[model samples]
Target chain A: MKWDFTSVFANTDALLAGAAGTLRIFAICLVLGLSLGLVVGLGRYARTWWFYLPATAFVEFFRNTPVLVQILWFYFALPMLLPFEISPLMAASLGISLNSAAFSAEIYRAGIQSIDRGQWDGARALGMRWAQAMRRIVLPQAIKRMLPALTNRAIEIFKMTTLASAVAYVELLQQGKLIASLNYNPIEAYTAVAVIFLVFLWPLVQFTYVLERRLKRDE
Target chain B: MAYQWDFTPVLANAPLLAQGLLNTLKVTGTSLVFGLALGLALALLRLSSRRTFAWPAGLVIEVFRTTPPLVQLFWFFFALPLLVGIEMTAFMAAVVTFSIQSAAFFAEVFRGGIVSIERGQWDGARAIGMNHGQALRRIVLPQAVKRMIPAFMERAIELMKTTTLVATISYADLLFAANEIAQKTFRPLETFTVAALIYFVVIFAFSLVARQFERRLAVSGESTVR
Candidate 1:
C-alpha cells in the first residue's frame, strides 16, 4: 500500500551498532579463517597420513554440514561438554571461521598445486628449505593466482557474518529484527537491511569480477 | 565431571529425524528444479541482444547473488506477506527464497557454460537452417549442460546445506528436528552431533558422487565449466 523508510532511518544508532558487530565478527573470522586455512591447506597438500587425513576429515565435515547447525552446536551443545559457557560471538565466530577455513583450504591447496614443479626444483637449487621455498617462491606466485578466489571467499565471509544473528549475536539482521518488531515496519526495516548489505557487498563483488578478468588476461 | 555422552534419546527420535531429513530433501529438490529452470531463463535473457531483456535479468541475478540468503529468507517470510496482503507459510517462504537465491547462482553457471561453447557452434547451427531457439535447444544447451554438470552438482550440494536455514523459520527440517530433540531430551550435545553427522553423510555422499562424475568427465577429456 504505502512505503516508508523514516522508521528505519530513525534507528540509525541501532543500525550503526549492528554494523560494528557485523564488522567485528567479519574481521575476526576473515583473519582466523584464512590464516588457519593456509595451514590446513598445507596439511591437505601433504603426503603424510598424519597431516593429510585429519585435514581431509576436517574439510569434509565442516564443508558438508550447514554452518547454522555448527553455530548452534557450538552455542548450545558445546557448553555441556565444557566447564564454561560459550558466548554468542565466540560460538558464531568459531563456526564461521572453521567453515570458511574448510572452504578456503581447498582454494589454497589448488593454488599451491597449480605451481609448476620446476619452481620447487629451482628453489632447491638455490639451497632453500621447504618452508623457505614455499614462503619465498611458491606462495608468492600462487597468491597472485588465488587472489580472485580468495577475494570471492572474503565476500562470502562478509555475507555469512549475518548468520551470527541466528545466535542473537547483535549483527545487522538481528538488529533489523528488533527494529521491525519495535517499529512495526517490517518492510522498511528489512528492506533497509538488505540495501545496507547490498551497499556493503556490491563493491566487493565488482572488485572480484575485476580481479577475475585481470587474472584471466594476465594468465 | 567429564560429561558422559549418550545417544539413546536421539536414537529414540529416529522417526522425527527421518521426517526432517525428508523435508530437507524435499526443499532441496524442489528448489533445485525451480532454480535450474529460472536460472536458464535468466541466463538466456542476460545473453540476449536487447538491453530490455538483459538488464532486468542482470539486475535480478546480481541482487539475489549479492544479498545474504538468510536476509532474503527473512524478507520473504516476514515482510512479503504483509506487503502483499497474504498469509505466507514458512515452507512457501523457504522454497521461494531458496529457489530464487539458488537461481541467481545457477544463472552464472549456465551463462559460463553457454559462453564456454565456441562461437562456431552457433554459426554451424545457423548454417544448418536452425533458428536461434532451436539451435540453442538442440545444439548449444546439450553441450553446455555437459560442461555444467560439475558446477551444477557443486551448487546442488551447497543448496542442500543452505536448506538448513529453513529450520530458523520454524520449518521442521533436520536442523530444526535436532533443536526439538535437544530441548525435549536435554541431550543437546548428542542430538546436535548426530544431526551434524546425518547432514555430513548425506551431503558427503553427494560430494563423492559428484567427484566421481567429475573424474569420469576428466577421463573423457571434457573440460568443465566452473
Candidate 2:
C-alpha cells in the first residue's frame, strides 16, 4: 500500500469550499449557542418556578438526546409541519446551536453559582437591582472563571460542525467524501481531512490547556 | 390545512425499532467495555516516566480526542480496509472507532483519578514492600477507581450518544433503523420523534442513576474527579 496525497492536494478548491462552510456554521452556532445559553442559564438561576422549570426541561431534553438525531429530525421531520422546506444549513445550525446552548447553559449556571454571595450583597448595597447586579457585577467575574470551560465548548462545537455533513451540508468532512469518491482515494482524502481538522483545532486545544493551567494557578 | 398527526405506521414497526435499540445498546456496551480497558492501558503508558511509552500514548489520546467521531468512523470504515487489506463490516468499524475514540476520553478520566490519589498512598504501599505495579493494583487503583466512577459514567453516557454516528456508515443502529422506518412508512415525523424519545429515555435513566451515585459519593464526603 502506497501513500499518496497528490489527489487530495489537487482538489484545493473543493477543500477550501468545505472549510468555508465549516467556518460559517461554526460562527453561527458559536454566537447563537453562547448567547442563548446565557438566557437559559439565567432562567435556571432564577428563584421562580416559571423560569426554572422550563429552562431545566430545555436543558434536560437537548442534553440527553444525540445531536445527530436532532439534526436529522430538523432536516427530515420538521418540514412536515412547516409551510416551507428547511435547508441543510438551517437544520444543522438549529440542531448544533440548540445542543450547544443546552450544554453551555450548565457551564454558565455553574459559573454564576460559583460567585461569592458578598458580590451580590455588595451590588445590592450600591443600589443595584437583580438585572443590574447580574450584568455589572456577577457576569463579569463569572465569565472569567467560565472562560476555560467556554473555550472547551467552542472546541466541541467546532468538532460537531462536521455532523452537518450527514445532512449533506458542504462541510470539511462532506468535501472529503466528495474528493474520496471522485478520486477513489479515501486514504489520502480522509487523511487530509483529518489533518486539516488537527491543524485547525490543535492550537485551540493547547490554548484551552494553557487557560486551564492559568486558571488553576490563579484560583 | 393542519398536518394531521399519525402514529399508526410508527407503532406498526415497533419490532424494527426495538431491534435497532438493541443494536444501539450492543454497540454502546461493546465500545464501553473495550474503551475502558484500552483507556486504562493508555493512561498507564501516559503516566509512565519513560518518554517513549508516554509520548505515543499522549499522541493517540490527543489525536482521537481532537478529531470528530464521525471523521474517525469514516476513516476506520472506508480508509482502513484498503490500507490493511481486510473487509471492514459496519459493526466492526463502529466498534473500532468508538472504542478508540471513547478510550481517548476515558484515558484522561483514569489519569485524573490516578493523579488525584495522594503521594502518601504510594509511600504507604512502598513502605509495606509492595512493588510499583503491586502498589498500583492493590492500593492506588482501588481507591482511584472509586473516585472515577462519576467521570466513567459520564464518558459512558457520551459514548452511548456517540454510537448514533454509526448509523451514518450504514450501521443499523437505532438512528439508522429510524431512517429506514421513516422512509418505508413515510412517517418521518412520528418515526424520528419516537427515535429521539427512545434515546432520551434510555440515556436520561442512565444520567439519573449516575447522579444518584454521585450524590451518594458526595454524602459520604468523597471527592470525585471529573
Candidate 3:
C-alpha cells in the first residue's frame, strides 16, 4: 500500500558494502579472466594441435553450461578435488572468472582473426618468433578491436556477480534480499537495489556504444 | 589424501533430478513461446509511429534489459505478492519473471531483425497492393526472421541458462534439486557435478542443433537469393 523508502534508506551502509563486494569480485574476475582468456585465445589461434585442442574443449564446455551451475560446482566439487578448502567467495570468483575466460577467449580470437593476414606474415618476415609476433604485432591491435565486446562482457560479469548470492556470498542482490526480508518492504528494497544496479551499469552500456561508434569511424 | 569418490547418493537421486529437468524444460519451453510472442508485440509497439506507444514500450524494454535477471526473479517472487496481496507459487513466480525478462531480450532481437529489413522492401510490398500489416507479415518478416535466427538461438541459450536462477526462488528446478540433494546427502560435490553435467550436455546438444539449423538456413537463403 505504501511506496515509502524510509527503511531502504536506513540501510545505506549495508547496501554500499554490498555494492563494494560486487565490484570487488568483478575486478578480480576481470583481471584473472582476461589473462586466462588471452592464453586460451592464443592457444586456439596456435597452429599446434596440442595447444588448440584442450583450449577449445575448455572454452566449449565452460561456454555451453550456465555460470550458476558452474559456481555451485566450484563451491562444492572443487573443495573435494583440491586439498585446500575454498571459501564460498573464492569459489564464486573462480567460477565466474573461468566462465568469463571462455567468453573472452572467443572474443579475443575473433579480434585476432580480424587482423589482416599480411600483418602476421609481415611479423614473420621480420624474423620474430610466434610469441614475439603475437605480442609485438598482433595483440595490441586485437586489444583495441576487442575493447567494446570485452567491456560488454565485463558488464555481463558484473551483472552476473549477483549469482554469487545464491551461494551465500552476501553481494548486492543478497544484501537487498536480506534487507527486504528484515524490513518487510520487499518492493522498496528491490527498487533501491535495481536503481543502484542501473546507475552502475547504464554508463558501461553507453561507453560501449560510444566505443562502437569510434571504432566504426576509424574503420 | 585418499578421500573416496562416491556417486551413490547422487545416482540414487536420479528421479528427483529428472523431475527437476522436466520442470526446467517445461518452464523454459513455455516461457520461450510466451516471451517471443510478447516480445514481438513490444518490438512492434516500440517501432510504432506514435510516440505515446513507442516511448513507454522503449522504457519497459530498457529497464528490464538493464537489470539483472536474478533481481527480477526476486522481485516477481517476493515483491509482486506483497503488492497484490495474493500469494503465488514459486513456479508461477519464475514463469512470470522469466517470461517478462526474456521478453525484453527477445524484443530487441525482433527489433534488430525488423530494422535490418531494407526500407525498399516495405515500399516494394506496398507497391504490390499490400497493406502495412500484409507487407510486414508477408514480405518483411520472412527475410527478417532469417537474420533473427542466430540472435534468437543465442538468446534461447541465455534464457535456458538463466532458468537456473529460478532455483534461488525455490522453484525445484534442476539446480534447486541438486542443492536439495547436496544438503540431504552431505555430498555437495557429487550432487552439483551431476547437475552441472546435465546442464552442459543439454546446452551443448542444443548448440550443435542450432548450428546445423543455421547452416541449412544459410544454404536455402543463398539459393533463394540467387
Using alpha carbons, what is the TM-score of model 2?
A: 0.99
* Per-model TM-score (chain A alone): 0.99, 0.99, 0.97
DockQ of all predictions against the true structure, Cα-based = 0.91, 0.90, 0.81
Which is the better candidate, 1 or 2, if ranked by lDDT?
Answer: 2
The list of candidate 2 runs beyond 4 A from truth reads none
Model 1, residue A53: displacement in angstroms? 1.2
lDDT of 1 by residue, B115-185 (tens): 99999999999999999999999999999999999999999999999999999889999999999999999
Candidate 2 A-chain TM-score: 0.99
**lDDT tens digits, residues A1-219, model 1?**
699999899999999999999999999999999999999999999999999999999999899999999999999999998999899999999999999999999999999999999999999999999999999999999999999999999999999999899899998999999999999999989999999999999999999999999999999
Q: Per-residue lDDT for B125-171 in model 3, tens only?
A: 99989999999999998888877887788789889999998888888
Task: Give the Cα RMSD of candidate 3.
Answer: 2.2
Give stretches of model 3 more than 4 Å off.
Answer: B218-226
lDDT of 3 at B132: 91
